[model samples]
Target: MDTHPLFIIIDDVHPILITELEKSGITCHYHPQITRNELLTIIHQYTGLVVRSKTPIDRELIDAASNLKIIGRYGAGMENIDTDYAESKGIVCLNAPEGNRNAVAEHTIGLLFALLNKICIANHQIKNGIWDRNNNWGQEITGKTIGIIGYGNTGSTFAKKLQGFDVTLLAYDKYKSGFGNEFVRETDMETIFAEADILSLHIPLTTETNNLVNRNFIEQFQKPFILLNTSRGQIVNTSDLVAAI
Candidate 1:
C-alpha cells in the first residue's frame, strides 16, 4: 500500500502554506497546467488538491476525485469551485482572498483617481507635446453619489477608503441588511439607479449573476454613470457598458 500522503497540486502556492503542508508530512506533485480532462484520470489517487481559477471544479470533477478530501483555492472568488457538489460529497473547499484583497483595493483606487483626474490622458498628451491646459479638464469625486453594488469585504473597504473624499456613498446588497454607516447610505437598487454618478461593481458572479447588468439594468439610470468593474468581468455587460460609456 502507498502510505505517502499524496497531493495532486496545481501551481506554486504560498511558501508558508507549502511549508505547513510539508510539516504535516505530505508528498506533493506539482502540475502547473493540469487540464480538467487530465485531472479526472488521476484524481482518485489524490487526497488534497490545490487549484486557482484555470478550470471549473464541477460535479464531474468531484465524482472523479473519490479520494479527494479537501480542495484549496490559491486566489479569491470560488466561482470556479463547485461548492454545492463538493459539500454534498463531504469535501472541504477553501480559498485565500486575504492575500490579494489589498492589491485589488489599491489598484481600484489608483484606477479611480486616474479615470476621475484624466491622469492617463494628460500623461499621454504631454508625452506627445500637446499640453493644452485649458482644453484638459478633470472632475472631482466630491459630492458625487457613488453607488456600490456589493458591500462585502472589498466593497466596504473601498467605501471606507473613499470616505475622506467627501463623496456621497450608497451601498446596496439584497442579501445583507444594516450595512449603513455615517459615511455610507444603505439603500435599495432604485435609489442607487437614480442617484449614483459613478457605479462600482463588487459583486461575485453566481447562478443569479450570470448577466446581472443588461439593457434594462442600465436603462434604470437617468445619468451617464462611470462604471468600474475590478471584480468580475461578466458581472458587467461588456457590450452594453461599451455602448453606454
Candidate 2:
C-alpha cells in the first residue's frame, strides 16, 4: 500500500505550485475547469485538494472526499470552505492569507483614484463623443477623509498605501483594537459615519456579515460618500444598494 499523497488542483493556480509539489514526490492532477459533478465522482481518490472560489466545500463535498487529508485554498477567506467540519474530520485547512494583500491594496487605491477623478465616466463620454470638461471636474483625495472597515491584511495594507495622500484615515474593525498609527486613526463606526468622505470595505462573508450593508446602513452616513467594497459581494445587499443608489 503506497502511503504517498495524491493531490487534485481543481482551480487555476501558478505553475510554481505544481512544480514545487511534484518536486516533493507528490502527484498532482490539474483540472482547472472541473465541474461540481465531475469533482464529486473523483474526489474520493485524492488525499489532498486545492481550490479557489469556484467550488463550495460543503458537507456533501467533504463526505465525498473520503481520502482527503488536507484542503488548500489558493487565496484568503476560507468562507467558501466548511473549515469547521473539515477540521473535525482531521483534515488540515490551509490558506495564504497574505498572498495577494498588496495586490488588493493597490487595486483598491486605483479604484479610489478612478472614482474620484471620474476616469471611467470620462472615458465612456470620450468614446461616445461627449467630452464635457465642466461636469467631469474631479475631486481631489488630498483633503478627503477615508473610512476603512476591517483591519486585516488587505485593510491594513490599504491604509499604509494612503500614507502620503494627506487624507484623514479612519479605520474601524469590530474585532480589533490598538492598530492606530500616525496615518490611520483607529475609530468606531459612528465617527466614520460622521466624517468619512469615502468608505471602503475589506471584510469577509459570514452569517453575521451577510447583507451587513443595507438601506439602513447606507442611511447612517452623515453625508454623501463614495463606497468601495473589495470584499465578498454578499456583504452588501444588492437590492438595497441598487435602491439606495
Candidate 3:
C-alpha cells in the first residue's frame, strides 16, 4: 500500500475517519492547537491537510506546503482556504457538508421556534420568578411566508423540515435554478422581500455573499420580518443587523 501523510488541524471528527485513513496507509497527525506560523513551518512535510476553519490556508501557507496535494475541510464552506489559488496549484479542496446538513437544518428550525415562542426569554424570566405571560405572547408559525436565501443543502433541508407547518416557502439561490420542490417555491428576490414574514439565511461566505444582508438589503423588505441565520456569521453584517433590529 502507498503511504500518504495527513495533518489534522482543529477538528473533533470521529475516530473512524482516522482509522480508515490509517487502514489505507495514510499517516494521520491530530494537532488541534497548531498555530498558523507552526503550520507554515511544517506543512511541507504532509501530502494532505485536514482542517475545520481555525487556520486560513492563504497563498503564503499554500506556497509553504510544497508537498500538499489535498485540503480536506471537516465541514462545509471553503472560504477559510484559498480554493482558487490552491486549485490553480493542482490541490484538490474537499468538504463534507452532508455530514452535518441535517443537524444544521434541524437546528435552524429549533432556533426559529425559540425566537417566535420567546423560549429563551421566557426560560430566563421564569427562572428569575417573573411570570409575565402577557409580554411573552408568541407568534404562530402557520400561514407565515418564509423566504430562504441560498437554497442549497441546509436551505432545502429547512424547507423539508417545514413540510407540515403550513407556511409558504420561498427559496432564492442566485447560482441555482430548477431546484424547487413541493415544499419550496423558487422565486425572485423581489417576491421574497415583498411577501415574506420570516427570512432565513443559509448562504456561504464569499466575496459576493459577504455582508450580503446589510442595511439596504434589510430595508428592501416591505414589512418587518423575523431574521434567522444558520450560516456563516460574516454573511450578515452585525452592525447593520443591530441597526435594523
Q: Top lDDT: which candidate number?
A: 2
Superior by TM-score: candidate 2 or candidate 3 = 2
The parts of candidate 1 lying over 4 Å away from their true place are 1-5, 24-26
Ranking 1 against 3 by TM-score, winner: 3
Q: Candidates' lDDT values, in order? A: 0.84, 0.95, 0.90
Off by over 4 Å in 2: none
lDDT of 1 by residue, 46-152 (tens): 99998888878899889999999899898878999999889899999988766766677677888888888889999999999988787668888888999998888
Better of 1 and 2 by lDDT: 2
Q: Identify the candidate with maximal TM-score.
A: 2
What are the RMSDs of all candidates, in order?
Answer: 2.1, 1.3, 1.6
Q: What range of 10 consecutive residues in model 1 has the weakest lDDT sum?
A: 96-105
Look at candidate 1 and give me any clashing residue pairs: none
Q: Give the deviation of candidate 3 from the true structure as CA RMSD.
A: 1.6
- Count of backbone clashes, every candidate in sequence: 0, 0, 0
Which pairs of residues clash in candidate 2, taking residues 3 or more apart in a chain or in different chains?
A: none
Q: Report the lDDT tens digits of candidate 3 across residue range 1-245.
A: 54566655556677898888789878888877878888788999888898887788899999999888999998898899999999999999999877778999999999999999999999999999999999999999999999999888888888998999999999999999998878789999999999999999988899999999999999999999999998899999999999988
